[model samples]
Target: DAGVTQSPTHLIKTRGQQVTLRCSPKSGHDTVSWYQQALGQGPQFIFQYYEEEERQRGNFPDRFSGHQFPNYSSELNVNALLLGDSALYLCASSVTGGELFFGEGSRLTVL
Candidate 1:
């Protein structure tokens, strides 16, 4: 039984570029959610996916999007990235009540 895991652990990009982060859900879990956590701030939900469809979404711009696979893994894509986009991108998994179990996150640094 594996918990959620993220790749690259860290990433670097420039303003106006694009970035993608990956996530694998916990075993036996079928829901995935993406969150953005700025330094010294709490995580803000981006979206949630279940059964390969988006079940819920947050107040994010069109530049933020995501995909969930049949295996329950997910990817978060951000376009035309900005320096303000520099934050910890977290992937969380849950069953019900939305009590999220988070991963270590993919840290993005916009230069």
Candidate 2:
């Protein structure tokens, strides 16, 4: 079975540029969650989508937004990105509230 996948293993951008990252959830999974992991820190939840609707959201600003498709694939969008927004964008898929399976993530670098 296929596992979760993410594109653009690394990227570089300047301040105020928007970026979009893609993810495909693991096979047989229905929920997809997005996380932001800064250097040397654990991943922080940004939002989760199930059945194409947002189910849970974390303490992220409005600039952080996401969408999930019927196939359990997801995309994260950040507008007016800042230096602070530079981090590893991780995508995790889970069936319940316990552990989550994550993708390698797309590392965003703001210069």
> Per-prediction TM-score, please?
0.95, 0.95
Q: lDDT for every model?
A: 0.92, 0.92
Model 2 poorest 10 in a row by lDDT? 93-102
- What is candidate 1's lDDT per residue for 15-75, written digit by digit as tens? 9999989999888888999999999999999999998998899989989999999888999
lDDT of 2 by residue, 1-111 (tens): 888899879999999999999999898888899999999999998999999999999999999988998788999999998999999999999885757899999999988
Model 2 TM-score is 0.95
Q: How many pairs collide in each candidate, listed in order?
A: 0, 0
Query: Candidate 2 deviates by what RMSD?
Result: 1.0
Off by over 4 Å in 2: none
